[model samples]
Target: MSTYSSNQEQFMYQTIIKWITDDRWMMDILRNVRSLSLPDSWVCAGFVRSKIWDQLHQIEPRTPLTDIDVVYYDATDLDKKTEKVWEQQLSRIQPELPWSVKNEARMHIVNGIAPYDSTVDAISYFPETATALGVRLDEQDQLILVAPCGLTDVFEMNIRVNPHFLQGRGDMETYTQRIQQKNWQHTWDRLTVVDS
Candidate 1:
């Protein structure tokens, strides 16, 4: 067991890397979710977003991918004509996944906690991997990112990371402008923890 504290290095060395390469576990999720569905109403926050951030910051060095962050593009898309759908979907797959389902937020807010404030949701703070974003796609290549999943109590939507959208605006202008004005160099200096 890990007593993850300020020792992020030790945590990554002992934990994160092992899970990333766990193909058996990963395939289990893929297979279980194969027959699963997407929320035509919500968007995802982690994997796709991480890819874009990685490309932009590759200027510094190649960043690895680990924790993904996701949110719905339009948060309020699901409401009517859904009964026990989320439970049905999640129940069918929960037994196969390593991570357990918790809250199903229409949008997982990234309120800029600290060091991670790289995006609206602070995705950049992840230690070993770049933050990511994902969304759901329809059969005709349309997006169903914010569809309501199971019952309200157990509603969990499935989403696909949208690399296509991330590739469009490479620089992420809105966030860059904010960081530039703040003088991140000085901010980092003031941080309790920082890179050399």
Candidate 2:
């Protein structure tokens, strides 16, 4: 259950949207992804999380993203090659940007879980609640945000394991390794990491 009320979630959603809108670079990335027109696609994970964390920390300049993660659901065409093709397309649009494209429909095979229902479903299963976020631009160029686990954790700078990870859908060792490797607290000093 979410600790935040619906109003709080809505407020945070609006806050995030406003932040992204103010960021020309982020808006451009969203625009580039929208051009692909992939079914149920969004730039997710650290791409969104890092932005919020950086904002919350009041970092002077934006933290450079290691890569822009683009995820879409296309059960009809689960070809992994399609992801690479999309990456190539995005690269042509912004060659300097590091882009990673993935078809969530086929990611289940890699994650050792039953097929995900949609891109949002796949996001909910991400290792950490803070990372289970996504955003995209709609036809009207309006920003849309999705956080299946809600916004409380991210807003509070809490890095807790997702419920799916706790339910045996994912393993602890992998989660632990990710937490250790990410060491997000080093970047966002206010963050509190909860492995268990």
Candidate 3:
């Protein structure tokens, strides 16, 4: 089974409305993509967190959403020039939104990179691909939500999200061990332990 359900978006909408006011921001962030002719989706894994909350957080009330995860699946069969055009266009667009960049706690993707960062160059630092229910917009402007599609969302585009950066060393065995040893909520405890 997938991590999300396309039909369950309403559940996501209702659950996070108190904090995110999601649709409004989605429409705004996507305005430029719509102008340049790209298709995208404002998906929430936390939406899945909605039903699973009682078992995890011990309450079903609103959780402070971390970020607005948007994945744009463009269908333009992009050549290098076409990709560059869209990338530059999007770079000019991100700042217009109110999302925070501190550790990418505001808005980001799971597959693609920041518009100014190239896949060939940035991939060394992050990976890019389509996300679950992987779908993108066609040149005609339609939302195709499916799985194993063209590209995953840009979860790596998040600012300073290198899961291992704080560790002064290049070895991530400790970090990987941390993730393996803990739950998602406390995944960053090692960093916070330093701050405390």
lDDT of 2 at 151: 91
**Candidate 1, 1-196: lDDT as tens digits:** 1122336434433332233224243334333433344322222333333223333233233233232222212234333223235434655656332222212222123222222111222221221112232233344543322111111110111122223223322233533453356342342232121111
Candidate 1 lDDT (Cα, whole model)?
0.29
Which residues of candidate 2, in runs, are more than 4 Å off?
A: 1-5
Model 2: per-residue Cα lDDT over 101-171, one tens digit each: 99999998987778889999889888899999999999998998898888989999999999875663777
lDDT string for model 3 (86-129, tens) is 55566578744323111121112432334312211121232112
Per-prediction TM-score to the true structure, in the order listed: 0.27, 0.95, 0.32
Clash count in backbone of candidate 3: 19
- Measured by lDDT, the strongest candidate is 2
Whole-model lDDT values for every prediction: 0.29, 0.90, 0.33
- Shift of residue 131 alpha carbon in model 1, Å: 4.6
Please give the lDDT score at residue 192 for candidate 2.
96
Error of 3 at 143 (Å): 10
lDDT of 2 at 4: 39
Name the 10 consecutive residues with the lowest summed lDDT in model 1.
Answer: 147-156
